[model samples]
Target: MSTRTLPPPPPPAEVRCWPDREALLADRAKAMAELHRLSIGVPRLLLLWLLACGLAVGWGLVGAALKTFEESRPDALSALFGVIFACTAAGFLIPTGIVMGLGVRRDKTVRERLTQWSSLDRDPTNDARFRSPGVSLCWFVPSFLLCTLGLWLSFATPATAERGQETYADVTMLMGLGLILWLTGLLGIAKAVSHFRWAVRLVTAVPVSAGDGGHR
Candidate 1:
């Protein structure tokens, strides 16, 4: 009286049929360009600038608190202010750090998943819009200038203090601001380079035919 168990039906296969090779290439190029645009869009850039500014301000606050502690005899008001500054700095820094760490992790995971999902089929550089010089230069100039300015500020002697009168707290604030700027600029430069390289690669790459397993 035992009943036979039937196996579950196999999942249905999903297929995308393109009208022609040109249609498929156009679709792929559009997708790749869109991804590039999203990566360096204005909203993302603004967020990065805000994050850098927050870190810089947090570090400055920490420096101020440390300066108060270095005073031989800080008054009650000064000490209270120092504590407040420290607490505020911690509030800003902790959340900023967490957001940055989480963003990096999420971006990595998304990129890995995307790599597994599909691949390029044709040279996207064939499209004039995709290989526009304006796009790369717009990113490069600002990034290069920021990097240069940051380096100069980091090494230049502080004008506020005489050579022998500089305090550790002052130095800490200057260095922290400079470091954040340097890192931000470097990130921008990397993005610009990546964009340039992608354009170049696309231009030189051979277009794959749909029959040759061009996309997966």
Candidate 2:
């Protein structure tokens, strides 16, 4: 019988140590900034805006179709146009939303992996700097504004046929826009709250010796 031999096991992964705690913190900050930039770049924002527009258009078309069907003499041409517009809008919005959501998830995973590799146990000073008031304010102000504006729009009374010249279709369009704004604003608010909580935790965390930073 021939003896079977297995190849040697791979060596254990090496842990990189920073010369000091400050160096480690600096590296962490830089990495985080880069990650943020990549996650919310201008292109991504533009794409989201476009998708939002598409959704609004879709809703408007759907409302128009409803109005047409309610009419005593509904035309086949208008119905066809409405169907085309709605399908187009859905074709753009659904796939784009899915792609963007997946992209966000992937970015989050990357951030977590990087943090695990580069984090230190105890560094209050560094943590404070990372979650500075300036940074927190930047996040908070926009989120607050979005939430406020969104809520106002969402709850505003829709124009009624008895009260105004606006048709049912017009009211429906306005309501759809408000709903989109509310959802977007809600998401922003959630993100801001999460950041605030993270800052508070960092401020209150206990400190210990961050001895020669090695494999986190």
Candidate 3:
């Protein structure tokens, strides 16, 4: 992952001063695009995590099938289960691995773009730093409710044979946690996207710099 930070903004007074919108809009658009590029990695990381969970589930199903076969005799159904589990695992793992790997590769490119855009002499928008507290609350509200319901169901439901005698409570707990984490990650990515949109609007609204200007 790229560890570089964006350069700091100019003085407060300069930030208050607006430049020529007509002249700076094009350059601002380019800079906004670059900023947008920097925000994709976190979402890709989240997706990778999701796929890993799927792989784990598939592996568990396969293990159950194997255990069943060893305890008794291999049946057509058992073989089918094993095959299905293998395919499911591969289905989740392969494409996700590829996409996440691509995201890693693109991280450097995004950082480089940010560096190039930083040379412009404009104050940075508070887009990334300026999220409303209510925004986070809104995201967490659904997550909390879902987690609560999931816990109730996990405890209420019985364990299935496919789960190898594991309690529904146990499995549900694991799944619920995974869901929470995934949702949290999605929230992060969404915030990053929102920041980009806010940056675009901020750029449009801010006064254009006469001598030099940069964008968020």
Candidate 4:
């Protein structure tokens, strides 16, 4: 029987420990804590902002619907509506357009912010504990439905009030459209924020237990 000697198994590869990566990951929890601190005041600020927009839409809808400026002056309210809607649409589209326009700027910001934290790095592990991506879809769905309904209601009727004509439908539609956009905008903002927050958590993560026995 020939004893076969396998070349002494290649010297076990040297193990390398990446303490910096680990340290960064551990520090990510601090990012969440900082975010929490920021959110404490942010929620109320957001709430107030929301309340103000609601009031604007509410008052505008009431004013437009109750007042027959559109009907009384065929060219008047229609023109006013066009102007206001155009301005509002422009306002939203402008900033978003600018951000999206310079594609590099936005992407860079997202990538950089995700990797870094103003106060601490993002924790990759902690990100897993939060919500799923599909979570965002919930917020936009309502905006789509409401906006659709609002649009339908707005155009179905005549602007002028006559023996049987009413412009309330149009007014309601405008308001609904405004609200839909407003709410959807909020959802979009939230989604963007979440992405970066998650990104921060992701960048600072290191797989301590990857392949065989590793530093956990």
Q: Judged by TM-score, which candidate is best?
A: 1
TM-score for candidate 1: 0.74
| Top-down TM-score ranking | 1, 2, 3, 4
Deviation from truth (RMSD, Å), model 2: 9.1
Candidate 4, 175-206: lDDT as tens digits: 55555455445544554465546545455555
Per-residue accuracy of model 2 over 100-140 as CA lDDT, tens digit each: 57655654554454344234444565455545455545555
Give me the runs in candidate 1 sitting further than 4 Å from their true place. Answer: 1-23, 104-119, 123-126, 158-164, 208-211
lDDT, candidate 1, 1-216, per-residue tens: 011211111112234456566666666555545544455555556676788788888888998888887673448888888899899999888998777666555444433322222243544445556555675676677778878877776877364456558887787778777777887788767766765665675556564344564433
lDDT of 4 at 25: 49
Residue by residue across 55-101, what tens digits does model 3's lDDT show?
A: 44644554554555555454777667656765765676577556555
Each candidate's TM vs. the true structure? 0.74, 0.64, 0.42, 0.39
Clashes of 1: 0
In candidate 3, which residue pairs get closer than 3 Å at backbone N, Cα or C atoms, i.e. clash? Answer: 18-207, 18-208, 19-207, 19-208, 19-209
Q: What is the lDDT of candidate 3?
A: 0.48
RMSD to the native, candidate 4? 15.2
lDDT value for model 4: 0.44
lDDT of the candidates, in the order given: 0.62, 0.54, 0.48, 0.44
